[model samples]
Target: MDMQSGTVEEALDKAAAVGVTAVVQVGCDLERSRWAAEVAGRHENVHATVALHPNEAPRIRREEGPGALDAALDEIAALAALPQVRGVGETGLDYFRTGADGIEAQTYSFRRHLRIAKEVGKALVIHDRDAHQDVLRVLREEGAPGTVVFHCFSGDAAMAEECAAAGYYMSFAGNVTFKSAQPLRDALAVAPLDLLLVETDAPFLTPAPYRGRPNAPYLIPVTLRAMAAVKGVDEDELATAVAANTARAFGCPPPR
Candidate 1:
């Protein structure tokens, strides 16, 4: 989540105390993507995913020019090829923030990121927000990568079933612990263990008991505990499965 340079080591230390041995630093734009790659290269426990966020794609086109957006996408493609860059994303449709006019730019960027993931043989991390059907439609149209994870998956049980059928990994985040998120809990219940993943989505969607506070990898156990309860499984059992699932999804070794 944008830990200041001076504080990153402390954050990682906190995370390790809770048995959280690995972190995936997501890059939403060129600057962050480059930073993520550098950080990943420096930290054995950290891996990176690079992309132009769904909203960022349109914002770039609007603020700069179409050429600028193209250049950013080009850079993302190059970053995706990096050894420590394990995926291409945080990219997909986001109708909640972007207007209809931005839809075309977002779609084009999503397609490009999807292609980049496939080309690099890396995971495609999707950021679907208020556009589930379109996200599925686009994935079908473009053909998804071998490993596709719906980061901070927000879909319901039916959508979870759809994802399960496609063998897409559904990663649950801290928001799944909220009282208003029974639908998410329901989705978690029916989701296959092999397809399950847990994320902090840090600095946002902090779990209950810590809601309104900035989230971090250390808080992953909080969300994992909640997820285990929803799935009616042992906490350690769930954690083990999630670790394997994450490794499989990103084509990396499971965090020890």
Candidate 2:
């Protein structure tokens, strides 16, 4: 919402007008992480997460070297300690965007993020794209944090079952409504309601019938409605469950 709307205030206002009570503004790098923390601090309805994106691993390694990557992780750790920063994330494996040579750096960065989240007692937000197996492997190898959320969950039923068994939250985005996303809906069907969450992935994955247009927290209802349909539950019931699940996952109460 901050990236798409005129200002953070405007985004929050718009979201509220459309029934959005709270939002977690995620950051992909140090600069954005700082911005997110600042936003969360000023807005009672907002929280933030800090981490370097998986695709950024190669660039950081190429331009600044491994030492710079370590330094950036250190900065991310510091930012993650902020009171409003409730998670360490947007980190995980992205084989689709990162090449083979960059996998090592990406894995290393992910491990550091896991450690930071654990140290700070925050949730772990994972961005797994075409690397589910590797992501799971790394989390297992490093020992996952108490709360783990798969942001814009892209796994199938089996993977959903695996994550559910491990008590990880699966946050569905607008992509789940795509006509080509039956498999995602299948995963949602099997996902435990207690561990299900909904997000906009705003300004990126707009729901069908509104795809290619800008997305914001206000548009979350569209995704939530679809999820409710998939789960065979009332929209309001699912919303309530997801709200509680989100608060539990991020360790924050809903906005009043």
| Every candidate's lDDT | 0.93, 0.92
| Model 2 TM-score relative to the real fold | 0.98
How do the residues 76-176 of candidate 1 rate in per-residue lDDT, one tens digit apiece? 99999999999998999999999999999999999999999999999999999999999999999999999999999999999999999999999999999
Off by over 4 Å in 1: none
Report clash pairs, candidate 1: none
Model 1 lDDT, residue 78, Cα = 91
The residue-level lDDT of candidate 1 at 143 comes to 96
Residue-level lDDT for 142 in candidate 1: 95
Candidate 2 residues lying further than 4 Å off, grouped into runs, are: none
